[model samples]
Target: MSSLLEITWTDPVTSRKGYVVIDTLVRGLASGGLRLRDGCTLDEVRGLAQGMTRKESLVYDPADRYLPLGGGKGGIDIDPGDPEAPEVLRRFLAAVRPIVKEQWNTGEDFGLRQETLDKVAADLGLASTVEAVFAILPDADAARQRLAEAFAVNVDGLCLADLVGGYGVAQACLVTAERMGLDHERVTAVVQGFGSIGGAVARYLAAAGVRVIAVADRDGLIRNDAGLDVELLLGARDGLGVIDRAVLRPGDRTGPREAWLDVPCDLLVPAAMSYVITEADTSRITARVVVEGANMPTLPEAEAALVTRGIPVVPDFLANVMTNAWWWWIVFGDIEPTAASSYSKIDSTMRRLVEAVSVEADRTGRTLRACALQLARRNAEAVTERAGVTG
Candidate 1:
């Protein structure tokens, strides 16, 4: 059965409606983020909440069992780019702060940042303001530190791998190459997003000797078989993650956005928005491996088609959960973070997760998705039992 969920809120200050979706809760606690986007829907928030709960349970050692931590997600349907959007968000939080303090812990997500979270906490006059802000804000410094600590214990000294989801994608590509008995050094990669996450992955792959041949962002796509300069391209990128078109020669660009998928490469990393790889574009993907850096970048049908073509995909939730886990531990446990500690934790968790899924899939002759789901379910069950919850 699907989990029971709830949504409620109202912003008297901005008159915006805020929706919080709680998928499950254990011991009166649930964790998730507040996403502000132009068209975020309640249904979308619900799905995200469920994903968080599963991810949290999986990474925190389900065998220790605890009632579900209850996953909750909140969002406001407004473009955060607007000048007054922050005020709108503040009002929204003010309306929901009472409920949030009691049960639903919210954090930063899409279009939300640490500064915004801090502002909201200050508006409410909370003590240990930074700590309180971190409690409900995703990826806050405190959250990151906690994650670093957990990851440090998990992997011991390999901090480079856990920087972000993009690093995870790079690791996945490495794992895929090793499994296929291909030369990792010769592999070429195409990244669909040039944001921090995507850029990090590209840089990591380049540093590791893989050729990153193509990169595309909201502005347009740039291709160079000779390999584009990661540092140069990053210099041209704006705060919104769009690459500046003026930096590239006209001939180096392509049109119609979707042309990015047609570029030939050994690996494709979709680090942009969700559902970018649809059924129509699935057949055009020439990459040997598709590692998602964003949540649900490929629809179920597209994933199935790719699998049918014998292409291996690392599931988004599995590949990207390390970041979520890191933040959760940071805020919940009050840990201090260092760059070395954070990177090591991300690297170890990603490596073990990719290797485990690969081994399970090979042993059972099942898809990576199937193996991942089975593992997630098993972990969830163990955690539930440890929490002494049965139904």
Candidate 2:
């Protein structure tokens, strides 16, 4: 069910090749992030969608308003640095326009800018990641209130924050650290990737007193035993999360590709791309815990190795469900919550959910991935079955 669509598109202007992948759909809706990267493939999109599926169903509060949504992911294979990026985006939107809608909503991932999403909206479309896709629309609340007055279904102005996903991941890490009895203020963490998600995780953890010892960006890996300053690093990074090595303190640079996997720390967060951590990387994984910040960052074999080695690996779907809660509020909350209120709500709930997940994983002696999957599917199926009953 991972691959629902694999379409190859030829640009009408440049005759360049492009692709789109729809991983899965549920109840006529499918949604996930759309990434642009060199060598990106349908298989990678499919795997990411699978995690999104789990995320859509991994309910923390289980209120009556929530329901599991289908998972869908999209990606385009292209040089992200192409000068004709606008044309590329236009072509992509045109190609995907026919198939994307209430049934298929997509949003930004790596190598994509918010302007691209604006382009999509200009074409009369929406973006749905783990949260309500309508949040990106103009005046989301007015649209919703108008629809409510009309007794209609209009999701105008449903919106999401850029850091919602990363915020959830940080909370998950904190929960894991707390459950393991690790001192949060003294935790040594290595974060791979400096984009929105990675930067947010680093900032959240660093603010909470975790020492971010290593940060691997597009340019290179930077390390500081005294803990790299997350704020300083964020200030020095580019939009793509590439670090300005020149801004670093002396003797704090790991340079490019210098064994990021073997760095000893209390936490290792793979927030970059998929398959970054594989079976071979396990032997080098010295962290007490690994919290996924990216979809499918760890291969099955690598996860198995961690489980066998008794290291708790917080699965991606479980660790990154912040947007799901937000979506629930967007569609189901009695009243709309402000950005700050929504984040505060998600943060507190995320910690509790992760704690529950960790406790259950220990009780079942299974990986966080397994526990999350079992619970998500179980809950989704139950709701599905209930809806099918005759009145």
Candidate 3:
């Protein structure tokens, strides 16, 4: 389906490009994130926006008070580390302020951080990054407070907000392991991109008794045959998810990022950038299962190759649905702001969603992504019908 709306904005000072794509809208509101990266493009944002549409639809629950919003995404082509990047983002947001105030509800994604986005948005006099959806809420102030409380939550020093998505990713891996008849305790995993998602996934998987043997970051790959200390590594990470090599222990070893594919593990998680795994790269995957922690980490041909090799993949949209769902759930009062409430909701919902896709894949003999997209489209149709919407 074609996007409902698309906009391109160029920063006057930096001549940097930015984009916004509203893939679809159930009501008046659309939800997604704004990302800042050196080479972001209209097409990438468009694809991500469409993914957001399926992501929103995938989490639809008739019994819950939260109705999923439509999908939208924003991207700017400026390196996050650039000295003038802040001003570039400010101008881009200003250029899109009208749409942001009314239709586009966004937070942070990829190269952008929530605190930075919130600070910029606040300086622009926007009530919040998600101010667009306030009008639809029964109690906007209450919802804001609830979400704030939720964001402030932590378990073992990790913020609940940062961990929810990774929790969902970990759940997918655990379930897939079970389906493949692998012992969770004996499972070994390698994770790429030690950012928020990858770090949290490693933490949760390690806590679940899965030995995380290798982790890759911007600096390179860190490996430990006996499993690196995930908690220590997490604490050593900076804002950009780069681990401090000073924290390395006796058993830990470091190598180039390419070595990530060489680590013998039962699960491989690409949690960093999009299109990191090409068709040829699939040949290097030794994992029995691949769980996407990042959006569009695997190319079409790579995914097909993995499928041909009898590897099961937990598609990104389904695997990473919890963070988006969790936000709306809190905003719409379907869930409390507590970590317990968030974890419980995400865990149960992810399990059911993953199981549904798995069952459908078995019945139809389709890849998990194909089956998941089928379920999402069906739900999107149901949501549209219930909303009395027609395109």
Candidate 4:
């Protein structure tokens, strides 16, 4: 029951392609991240936009109600290494100028960053920053300012990318573990991917006394039964999330970068790229719980196998609800995000969401992913009903 609209524009002069895929527009507005990657395609944009719809609308209901925002995604297909990248982006932006004001809004994603997008957004003659391109309209800007006012900060101070998804993943792991009756203070976990989201989650989990027994980055996988020193590994990690093999100690175990799948622990977090887990990985997935920290990390066959084996595959849609929750709260309520309180808010909300879904899953004897999909589907129904759009 996913919905979408695909818009593609190609600059004749630059030969660069731009895309806007709106999964469904609630109240005539759609929003999501804008990604930049080489070889980007329309199908990929549609998939991401659909994920965005699920992420924003799913409220763990029949657990709770929520404000439904339709999902949209933007993609610019061009290599960043090209010397004419800026010019190419300008041309692409111009191609979509009309719709950028009316139909869709976007923020940075994948190869893009909010700071860089904000700095360069002016060239596109757009009021929205690349971080939050769709929020340029007066209503959206006023809403952001209200969020700022709640936090007693300036309008320009808010940045959703700081810790939203990463923090939620860690919090959900802890809460999910507890819901399974693993009430101990120190739960062990193995994480794949060592970059921004992965690193942030690992750091937070380690600090919270979760034994991060193994870590995988682009360079290789490192394991320690007694738990790796997250701080030390963080220091050794490169920009690409690659940890140097030389940083390993004498007794530590090392394997291929993808060997993280074989590590035994109470929790497994796939925080890297999509579809890392396939049918082949099911045999090696020893962890009791698989918390998806990335979009579509587990393939269909692998997911079914895990669920059939009594393993809980927490879907990305439910695990990464912090950002959407934050946005919903600020716009619907008075709470504004602040440096000091944002972490606490994300932690509490994530714990609540994970617990709710876990409870429902336990009661219904269903996989966590199934429970999430149920909630997302129901929420989509609510949106369609309220918006008076015939399904």
For lDDT, candidate 1 versus 4, the one ahead is 4
Model 1 scores worst on lDDT over the 10 consecutive residues at 154-163
User: Which regions in candidate 1 have their CA more than 4 angstroms from the true location?
Assistant: 8-17, 62-68, 126-163, 249-254, 331-336, 389-391
Which wins on lDDT, candidate 2 or candidate 3?
3
Best by TM-score: 3
Off by over 4 Å in 3: none
Candidate 1: tens digits of C-alpha lDDT, residues 1-391: 3656566565565566668776777555676767777767777777777777766655655322112365667888777787878888877777767657766766556666644676677778643222433444545564555544543542223232234556666777777777878786788988888765677778778878888888888767788887877767777777566777777754365555667798889888887666789988988998898888776789889999999998888887777675566554355543235555555666666777778889999999999878987887787777676766532
TM-score of each: 0.83, 0.86, 0.98, 0.83
For all the candidates, what are their Cα RMSDs to the real structure? 5.1, 5.3, 1.1, 4.2
Candidate 2: clashing pairs of residues: 134-158, 135-158, 135-159, 140-156, 140-157
Off by over 4 Å in 4: 9-18, 37-39, 60-66, 76-91, 130-142, 146-160, 236-239, 244-254, 331-334, 384-391
lDDT of 4 by residue, 328-364 (tens): 5555443445544566667766776677677888899
Give the per-residue lDDT digits (tens) of candidate 3, residues 277-306: 999888888899999999888888899899
- RMSD after Cα superposition, model 1: 5.1
Q: List the residue pairs that clash in candidate 3.
A: none
Number of the candidate with higher TM-score, 2 or 3: 3
Alpha-carbon lDDT, every model: 0.69, 0.71, 0.90, 0.72
Per-residue lDDT of 1-391 in model 2, one digit per residue for the tens?
Answer: 5366777777677655566665555555666767777777767776777777778767634554445566777777766777765677677766777666545566677788655665555665443222243443456575455323322222222223556667788888888898899998889999888887888888889878998899887777888889887787777777678877777888586767536787899999998787898888798888999999888888998999987997878988888777544544555552254555556777777876687777788898777877878888786676566445311
Model 4 whole-model lDDT (C-alpha atoms):
0.72
| Candidate 3 TM-score, C-alpha based | 0.98
